[model samples]
Target: MVNSVPDCDFTADYLTATEADNLLAHCLTALPWQQEDILLFGRTVAQPRLQVWMGEPDAVYRYSGTDFVPVPWDAQIRALCTRLARDCGTRFNSVLCNLYQHGQHSMGWHADDEPELGPEPVIASLSLGHARRFVLRPRAKGNPDRHEWSLGHGDLLVMRGQTQQHWLHGIPKTRRAVGPRVNLTFRRLLGAEVSAGRAESAEIDVG
Candidate 1:
């Protein structure tokens, strides 16, 4: 229902409030969340939020100068991926789980343009817990095309086609008192074999 952007879809209530609340409670205590250090501005620093990368065995992903070996998929997440495949019409082999403990935890502007994701990747983002602002802007400098949405609990946002190639998106840190939020971005990693060496270095701000 997001008409202002191309190759993007939004559903404000993807799941019933009860279902979302239950899932949020389970994820908060179940997922193995970790705060990893990432290279930013040529310096190593801890990521602002906690995260866990989960996927099929071969779905290794590399970003922000680090190679992440996929953790085995959790039962809840695997079931969600199956549902997303049916609903979004794309198969997802991997998922990046981000946990924002509060308003201060956030993601910075970056595109999911890594080579392993392929040229036109389909990204299905599911939100749980507190609502937060998600923004997108044209990657080209000063084009003035921008879009934002209040992604609340159980909302689903799908970004596909040329969205990553032409635009950059992120959730900025907010000063308001907000509760914890969890964002799951499901994706399909291409390539029959994982690359041996690092891809070209690019700064990534992930939550």
Candidate 2:
């Protein structure tokens, strides 16, 4: 509970900083043949991208109204998920891994609301390596509505409750000084298909 935010049941810990770093080093070295960078707004963005896959055979990840086949998991990743779940005070089934090479590499404005996420899905995020600004803004119109913080190596962020419904979060690209960072967001998609057409839609990797 080192970096616990106010009114946020979530807790961010640096307890396993060293271990996380060690695991990340191994991941960088052995995560199969690298995944191709996906196009984002026609920029063909690179690092800070993703590989949406499921852990179980029946597990399927739905992102941006699309489905995806999860890549196979290794021991290190499985251990990471276990640790993150215990730290976040919730359970997780799938993990979305992100590789951010530099300060310029970042995620944009968006909420994890794929309809498949259900109402108020719980999201546990783990950061390894470089530190960057993590910002959250209220979805509703408001004058003073910007919340930002720096998440360094080993920090864990758990967002729950009405967070997804009321706010949108992102890791904006910055020209500031930084190094490579890898983040894994663990999520649980309770077997519920909100719509029928969604099940047939092509899985689009719009990073």
Candidate 3:
């Protein structure tokens, strides 16, 4: 469950199936989930899926042309982060929780290269519920190669070092009928103040 690519680590069963199911259920009911809008092509539009941003007080993250001040983490999430950090050997102060309600909901190709993430950020992504295809491709030309992995329930993937500098990763939309999936990407934000400035867009809550 490891990759030859430097700084890329994958664990197929980071959590037991029962543990993953319990955690997913807790997050669905406890976390404050919201469907955000991003400014794309000069017009704001809804994000493809629902998400909940949770972090420490200073770990506000900004991306997709919007600033997100994370809500405080739930106790379960904090404990899970502690365990994940210990296993991954990197501390995490923030997390972005994404819930794809069905096959059509997905995340497009993008890199986690926000300024607040600093250089060479370590991102630990945990997946639960339905399995989905996670893809990565090189940004540079002449390396027409693609890497794909089936991120299954309770799987964990860690990307670090120059992974973000040279690669893009995402979960593409699928037409097959699939159940909901929950993904949590843990991050460590560099020094930055939490700003009240919010992007001019609407937030749709489907709770």
Candidate 4:
């Protein structure tokens, strides 16, 4: 799928110095140190998030085939999750945070299309610190038109239903002098395989 692109929720919010600092403070204090993998290029990346599970207790995603255990919520984390959900006009009980220390850190192109997320999943994303470009390309089976946006500090990018299924998204590298950056995404998930015993699961194994 790479032909048509959806209407862009590709947006960013410029923050006053204080506002950016405040969010960064919460993320640093509240978020756990994330373990990450090198993307397509084998570069280092960090994603701190709670685990999420769907379907049967051992059920794994068709895409990543991962089973995870959720991280207990920190006070700041809970507050951020709640606020983001309210702002995006959606409800989310979990969040994934990515931390990039310098220009070299980045993520490869991919879609959050796992089955557990249910069809047409909703994502609420918040960015802090250095500004970075987030590129999105149509993956409509045979299309190639691409769209891009710069996610500035304190910016919020909300990806809605159909957004993930139709396209791939990623953070590209930059040569400009940029400080550390953090991103938070909130989403809700449920599936037939998930039961009370196996939730709070998340895994980031890219095939």
Candidate 1 structure, TM-score to reference: 0.91
lDDT of 2 at 120: 74
Q: What are the runs in model 2 whose C-alpha is more than 4 Å off?
A: 1-12, 33-54, 192-207
For each candidate, the alpha-carbon lDDT, in order, equals: 0.86, 0.65, 0.82, 0.62
Candidate achieving higher lDDT, 3 or 4: 3
Rank order (by lDDT, best first): 1, 3, 2, 4
lDDT of 3 by residue, 53-162 (tens): 89898777555467788899899889999999999888999899999999888887777776667679999999999999988877676766788899999999999998
lDDT of 2 by residue, 99-177 (tens): 7777666676667766667777888777878888888776566634777778877777777777776766788877888
Candidate 1's residue-wise lDDT over 126-204, tens digit each?
A: 9999999998987777678888899999999999999988888989888899999999999999963454333223434
Ranking by TM-score: 1, 3, 2, 4
Lowest summed lDDT across 10 adjacent residues in model 1 is found at: 195-204
Q: Which stretches of candidate 3 lie over 4 Å from their true place?
A: 1-6, 194-207
TM-score against native, each model: 0.91, 0.77, 0.89, 0.73
* Candidate with better TM-score, 3 vs 4: 3
On lDDT, the candidate that comes out on top is: 1
In candidate 3, the residue pairs with backbone N, CA or C atoms under 3 Å apart (3 or more residues apart, or in different chains) clash, namely: none
Query: Which whole-number lDDT from 0 to 100 does residue 3 have in model 4?
Result: 31
Task: Report each candidate's C-alpha RMSD, comma-separated, in the order given.
Answer: 3.2, 5.6, 5.1, 6.4
